[model samples]
Target: MAGGFTTMKTLLYRLFVLAILLSPVYTSDHSAMCAEAATPQTAAQKQKAAAQAKKKKEADKKRAQKKKEQVKKQKAQQKAAAEKQEARAKQQEKAAKAQAQKQAQKQEEEEELKQAWLRQQAELNSSTPKKEVVSLINIGAKFGYAGIMDKMTNNYANISRPNELDNDYAYHSLKGGPGAGLSLTYELQYGAFRFETGFDFTYLNSTSAYEFSLMRRLEQPYGGNYFYITDDLRETRNAGYVGLPIMFGAQFSRYYFMAGAKVGYGLFGNYKQRGRYDIVVKDDALRDPYGLGIHDVPTLAKDQRKLSLQQPSVSLCAEVGIDLDEWLQAQPDKKNKKRTKPGERLPFGREHLHYKLGIFAEYGILNTNKPTGALPLSFNADDPYPQQTNSMLSIADTRVNNLFVGVKFAIQFEIPGKVARPIPAPASAAEISVFDKESMTSLTTAIVQVKNTGNNRTIMKPKTLSKGVIRQRAAVGEYVAMAKAKNYYPESVAFTVDSPGIVVPVKIYMQRRPVFQVKVTDKETGAALAAQVQITKRNDKETAYSMQTDSVNGLSEVMLQDSLQYALHIEQIGYEAVDTLISDIGDKMHISLTPIKKGEIFVMKNLFFATNKTRILSSSEEALEALFGYLERNPEIRIKIMGHTDNVGKDEANQRLSEGRANAVREDLIKRGIDETRIEAEGYGETLPVDTNDTEEGRQNNRRVEIEIL
Candidate 1:
């Protein structure tokens, strides 16, 4: 039995070892099993063994629950770590993207800044200066014809002569010559006008051919001089002159006109003559019973000689031509662009490029007939030379008048600088309302006409209104609006649009207009003239109605407002434009227009100057504009502007001020496109007063400007 027990113990030990090796749970509970194995017991031990087995089973369950809890906690910790790593990676990626975007934006902004700087620099380089003084140098060459105008008649160099015997006769004919000149002109431009003070080295060669003859009866026959004898001489003479011209020129577009006086010095002259003479001799009274018998000895003497002429010559010069500056060509699209400066390089191999080509005519106002000395003729005195005895054969019949006509070419070079640009018309909008002023009601049936006064562009033609309001886009400029209705007299208003995109409203009052007829007649003659008649509101200078008189009758009829003050403006091409305030609209208004002739004076009442200053005022704009228009219409007419001042200041100061004021007006006219040569400015100061300067009213009259037609 002991042996059997030993075997079971061995087997149990082996089983315990196998369980420990095969089951990790059993190995972990080995301490509890060892404690149980060390205990010794009987039936209580058996019951304890059963209780222990139950406890062991409960411990295994508790351990398994703890292990499952630990495993779940570990898995949760691992998942949290993985999530945190993924979040870190995503954050790094987001930061990198933001940095790249920031760099890109910064680069773009820098590029824009660089471009803006470049543009700013370009603007600084390209912009022109304002109101710069321009210096111009002009050189030209010219050639033309010559003519002699003789004031003397009936003696020598006359075109008409009597056919009777013993009559003194002379004839003169002009032959043209070549002229060349080099001019250095220093010009100061005031607007479109230029005041030029220059020296011209002009060489002129003028040729005049003349014939003279005289016959007479001698008192006694002596030394073969029996009958009277004279020589019929044909002579050709050349006169050369060097002149200096002082001129004023005006430029309008490409065309320019200049008028001035040239003071010339006669440098040298020469003459050649050939003649036929009838020599009458007594011949000792051959075959005659008395001594009264004389022989007719006629001789044809053809002689040629050189003579000299002299004097200081004065001439009037005038030129009309076009400037061939490529920049001066009409380009409406590039009107606002920067103009080609004087020093700017031009294309087409052109240098010194301001070229002018035109026709010029000069006439000597002074008689160019001063003989330096006499030439002794080489003739046979023994044969009785009657032509040499008379003083008429020695430079007496020669008359010379300098005249020239030819093409002139000029090149102008200018200094580089800034200049004031032309002021353009202001941009504006028109808000037109057609309404009855007295009734304060909108006239839906009224027609409105809107026209731009600057360019004479028809902004809106006469259109019947529907709602009495119309919005039209227009440039900044002066405009005329006319409203017409059936019963209400047509009303017109001059409105100025001063701002861009802003609407300017014009109001015209309607009233019962009275029909008036105007009969235009010449002041000197009772004849009619073709004229344009404009009836305008006196205050605003707005044309209420415009009509043209019949060319034959010179009559225009229009409806006019009786209550409103009115002014009449009459314009004709050959007559001075008249602007007069109408005192009475009735009585078959007989308006007289004066013909614009040389020496006619027209007072410019509205030309304004600042106190002791030469600057033009804005208030005088309308008047100056009217003057400019008048000048434009009469392109051939020349005017002299004379300025006067009240005798309040010193004579010298007043003179300077008056002159400056006159020049200021001239400059303004030139700016408006009047040519410089067409106008001349002078100052009389207090020297020539129109009225007494003792009273303020008289002084106001004395302080005035006048324009004389020349």
Candidate 2:
């Protein structure tokens, strides 16, 4: 074994050496194998890793691209939304600006109207008068006829027997004579009413004639005889009286009438008489010789008497006359050569001496005759000369009244009374200035007036301002200062004069009226058209101006307030009416009107109705008037009223509503004096639409009432 071991060792050594050498080869091979195996696996892993990395990179790129696309889309949406928001904000700002402008214009108009009214009132207060009472005295003289009226009755009888006859007679005649009177009167007059009281003196004269006769058969120693005697007398009477008269009357213009009572007392009366008479008698016993008798007889002395009047008289007196001063003043006074002040009276002027001439009458309403038991005629036959007496008034059994009628002349003097003193002007004056409102420039030619509001009297007359200013002296009171200039609105300012010497400064700003030329033309042809243009205040409907445009120029010029709103209406024959508001006066107005003809359609823009109903509102008056006027101007034209509605309700309901609206419009035209046959009504419910019904604006356009010429 040892040997074998040695041999094997040696062999092993060699084998070892060989194994070593092969080991290197095996190591190399194994290493190569491991390297090959590792190479393939590493290569496969590298390939798998590379393929995975590529796939992941591709997925990351795809995700990143998708995210970019999403962001882009989001950014696009944001841009669109921002643009929409910006557009909406711009629209709102534009609307707000328009509304503000409209409101400002309306406010300016109202202020101007108020200023005009104040100036008008100030002018009316400066033109009125004053009233007072007066006192006067009058002295007058009168001449007239005085008469005594006596009622007389006479009884006479005649008896005839075989041998005796007797007769008696008495007669008297009285006549009136001239009279004169003097009077002094005091008078008080207030406006048309007057009172007068006075004392007067009168003298009267009268004349009368009296006759008496008596014949009696006397039985003497001789056979039957007849005796007769007669007497005649004439008399004159004078009377004087004192009287007091009280009168109340009214004077109308230059004429006056007074009626009252006059009480009088008779002071004295006297009478005188002169004349002749005749008598005759016949005797039967002396028939053989002759029928003889006394033929003529007269009183031994002329009858005359004087006595005091015993009765007082009360009489109703009335007088009517014209103021002679009024007529005298109208006559030329050539004799008045004295220079007189503004209100001074001339030395013999009729102003202080009022002369009146009037007719007056007085009647005594009491009995003046005294009755005594004395025969009218008396005679004594025994004496050679028979005595006879006559009393005519004593025999009368009635009352006697005295009457006087006369023309009176009177002169009146007005007694000066306490004169009303005028209110003194203030020591200090106020400056009133007139200026243009827009330019703040002074107006030199502006008329300035200052009025005292307490008395409504003008403190200063309307006078042209000097250098746009006027100094006014006013009493302590409220006052108004008014200023006006040509082509400018009048203005008034109220101020208070608190003290007598306060110097107040008053400023009045006048606005210049805007003058505009209005032109009307045909819409289609752009040609001038003659039309009637009417401008009215928008608030009160008061017509401010009305005129017809010139036929050639179709132009009318008018003054308008820049601050006021006005309604302008233009109309012409065979043309559609134009109604518009004039809110701005920056330029001349150009109104274009469409011609009315067959197949022409016009929307009634201003027509308004009650909510959801066909009843017309009062605000629709202007529209209705325009339509009526158009129809009236063209009598031969026929029209159709068509109504439409938005598509918001049932078709049937909408149809009914549209029909009702159309009929309402038609009926309104008929009521406004249009012929019923000239208008026809129809409805198209949502079928014929002017605009889309989806939006609110579109729906509003679709719902309309229009007139169509037929």
Candidate 3:
């Protein structure tokens, strides 16, 4: 940027210097032309006219500036294009690389699995398989929450006998977190069975703190002195292990007998600092160690080395589960060869099997140096003696034992369809058509004639997308109600009976409706109206109603059967009638009908008023005859009466006239027994006009009163 700015400045200075040097030439030319003009030569004066010359100079400067701007814009566009192209190329390269890597990894795994399957198949084909007719796959979760894995160690804390640390040892259980596992299996000849394998891992980090009575050390010393732990030493089992267990089983019908072993080599097992040391030296009747020497003498203290609680280890287990259902399925009779087709696959019908729950038990063989517990339970508080705070119990030298007990739940399923195949797809449309004996080539249909009777315009039109693409184009579900009466469908040839002979004919529907559905309204007032809407059809007597416009939507659609001279009428509560035919649809058919003034106001056709008077005259009885007819035709013709008077007399008279006229109309309507429940009357006296009141003709036109459909 700095370099560019410097270059620009240098160029500007050069241009300025050149312009200054050329100043004399222009001045000299101007002086010569002026002097020649003063000599009265009309040719010279015309050659350099002041206004023309000035305009030409300004135009030249403007042209130069515009040219510079164009060059700059072109360079900018080129730079942007280059950047965009580079970015696209890089993105494409990255995507290709990632796709290639993914494909390669998938292929590698597939190849490996393929090879393994081949090996299994070869072995199976070479020998008779050991058969076990059973079914069940049960999983279990074992939590090491109550027990610390055991380890056999030569540490001081592990003393077999309380006072015989040098002679023997004992082991204490380690405590930890929770763990779980999963299993898989299959059915065999005998009963229910499982080939289960799963993983479980946990961590146990415990804190130990203690306070003990200070005691004198070195008996008979010259000066009596009390001894205390200078620092805290802790024993924390923050170790963890992942277990892999695989078990096999056999089911004696309702009796499930299972035995499988799981071997898990210790992933990692170790101890951390946080526990104080515990010694029996002071408590022992003999204050000193026994004659036999032991590296760690018993002394209840908080200072000691954290025992190396870590060890590479291995363990094994066996478990069993059962299902209580004793139901046995009956065998199928052999098929008669004469009644069967050759090369037909065996039926091997689906198994409708049921299952029940049962109990389970397991046992394990402990290994490694730590004092591990065979069972997940503890005698009390998990420590046999949790009150013995951070003190290392003299348990390392003890003998360990195996465990076996407990019960759990189980379920079974007889898988359907070989090990894999699922339901196949149904026959194709063409095949179904053939079976039905219907024509493969069906008819086309349009929906231009089917108009939405919904009131809301926004809800009427299909929503188009941001880029103008219809993301969710309007569509009718295939479950359209089919009946014989008023068959307005199959507008275009796209929809037709695919089958004509068998059962009900199958019809093919189009993705998009072919008819141009229109919502008509008055362009001047944004109002809707009723018209003699026509939707020509090939079958004219199909009972199809020409006027589908309801109170909600002033619209009707058709397939555009013949000429598109569809009549349109703009009918609103106050506007006069407008009748026209739409022939030109420049764009997607959004036809707006501009209503020419048919009447000054919209008075209810069924409503009436006094003849030329504001009184509620009784003779105006039948003005609403047609209105009643309309109500009979449309049960929901809600209406209101609006009265207007021309500018005359005083403001109060005009107002009274307007109000009286409206009331008179209402009264006559009520007299005809039109429901007063559906009407309200309002008067606007001389406030609006049909034309300008500046002339006598315009005033006369405005002086008249009019009725309005509110």
Candidate 4:
């Protein structure tokens, strides 16, 4: 790690040195521009930088937060940057604790927004052969002439054969009807014996280049320094090829002659070595060959069989031509034994180049085999369906008869083309290595839309996005025209969606609702009992959705439907008050408190007090205790407490007795924790209603203080 740090420092130093070496003016200028842009709110860039640095020190342990894109929407009524860097610096930290919570219960409006960024990329590869662009330039195009001769059109390259060529030797011999296939010549220094392909008007679709063999067309030389002769004439029986022909010219001084021959496989294309022939054919020509029907016809197979129109078969053809006036002659009969003029004649073999045009006769032998009997021309018992397939005609114009009888009209051209070379295979060590791709750890997210819920539409920039932001966009515009759009959502509705099971604090607009309210009344004789009431709040966002209830007229005036169903009850003496779920509600609501009228009230006998003393015995603890809750229930009722006394003392003593007794009773009620305002003590002085006190029991009853409900 230390080495890495040192290397990083060195790299930084090198970069700084390189930066200095470049135009410092421009670099400094760009730095100043960035500084100014970053300090838009400051008078000077330095001041802003200092402020930022100071703030950074204060925010030492602050963590960064990731920002999320938020979009919100609503029904019927809907509503829905430069600080960008600052926000990014604090995004992750902010989102971690980010929340839209409302503190007050007065409003029931909710809005949320979240935003996130996403990125994606793709690539593809393969392990197959690469595409190739072929051209002959790699080597060179095979040079050759490909065309058919209708009849050699008065050209020196014309041929004339009477026996086999129908009379019109011009067309019948050259173009050769279905006989002329193609004339393709190739000289390849390398490569294989490819198939000879050409464009034939008779069959033009065979356009592929096939491999050809390196079969040399040279013949053996007999004497010391011998010239090349046709292979068959040199090798005799050793060479069996008798169908395909390869023609080339040999020149000596002013005389030149064209010479070539045909070669082909044995019958049924049987192997010359060790393969068995699958099928066989009759040897009507004394050429016993293994193969199928009419296949063993080499003794009569035509050289121009590929042409199909005119057959140039079974013979050696030689023609002579001179630059101006040359001559062609036959070989000595002692050595070869063949001629066009017959009987050791001197043919047009060689001469001087003095004539403007030279014409010479040509000869072709069909190499036919006769049966030593009259050659059958038709089917018979000895030779049923006899078919004479070979024809040997001597001395005639044939395949390579170049008897120049007129001026030659031709042009020489250089053909630029391509040749194919076998591509070398790659080595095993050159193979490519592949590895598994890494998975994405950062989350991918995007905002579908943002909606504005305010009276006026507001812009939603990337940086100013809130976690509770809501917005919806529309494309309702004509071409090149403004669109019809407005802010969405009304403020009066109160609907919200929160994360399941958890409610975030939020502010929302809502209509007011009736909570709980009640009026007290006496049950026994239908009288009003003004009772005290108390109300309070409970939830996550706020303490309550409505007002709190407390000691009052047993009725609460507030705006909230939740509080209506809250616990509500009233208490009173001699009454089993009802506790109800405050459910029924309309435009307004009212509830009546009924007092208990069924159960009887407990009565306690009173006790006499001594003169002038206001203290009561402990026995008074039991006296009027049942009525303690009664006074507590009716807190608004004010009543007077009266006292009576027996006639056993002076008038002043009696008055004191009344006052003392009344005071004693008042003290008793006050001691019972009743509101002093509901109790008024009065000394009646033996004037108030009293039970008969003449007897001792009546006197005891008459000694009781009278408590009344005002």
TM-scores of the models, in the given order? 0.33, 0.35, 0.29, 0.18
Q: Tens digit of lDDT per residue, candidate 4, span 1-710? A: 99999999999999998877587797888899889887766666778888998898667534221111122222212331335556675885666545322322112211110100000001112233233222111111111212121111122221122112222221222211111122233321111111111111111111111111011111222111111111111000111122444434543545555455433222211101111111122333435433322212123233421221123323343334453322322122333212111223232221100221222221224422111222101122322222432111111332221111112211111122121111111111111111111221211111212223432343223221133222322222111101111111112212232222122222222122333355555555455544433322222222232222233433445444432334444444444445544445322334455553322322134344554465666655434553565676666666666777666557687777778777767777788798777777877665653567578877666565665556
| Cα lDDT of model 2 by residue, 543-646, tens digit | 99877777577788877766778889886645778888886664588898889779878788668888678898998776677678667756889998999999
Total clashing pairs in model 3: 68
Q: What is the C-alpha RMSD of each candidate to the true structure, in Å?
A: 41.7, 32.9, 27.9, 41.8
Residue 499's lDDT within candidate 1 is 50
Candidate 2, superposed: residue stretches over 4 Å from native: 1-133, 154-174, 209-233, 282-304, 329-350, 376-381, 384-391, 396-398, 419-710
Residue 550's lDDT in candidate 2: 71
Segments in model 4 whose C-alpha atoms lie over 4 Å from true places: 1-604, 607-613
Candidate 3, 6-26: lDDT as tens digits: 999999999998897689888
Q: What's the candidate order when arranged by decreasing lDDT?
A: 2, 1, 3, 4
Q: Which one wins by lDDT: 1 or 2? A: 2
| lDDT for position 324 in model 2 | 82
For candidate 1, the per-residue lDDT at 165 reads 24
Q: Candidate 1, overall lDDT?
A: 0.66
Q: Model 1, residue 247: what's the lDDT?
A: 79
How does residue 243 of candidate 4 score in lDDT? 42
Model 3 scores a TM of 0.29
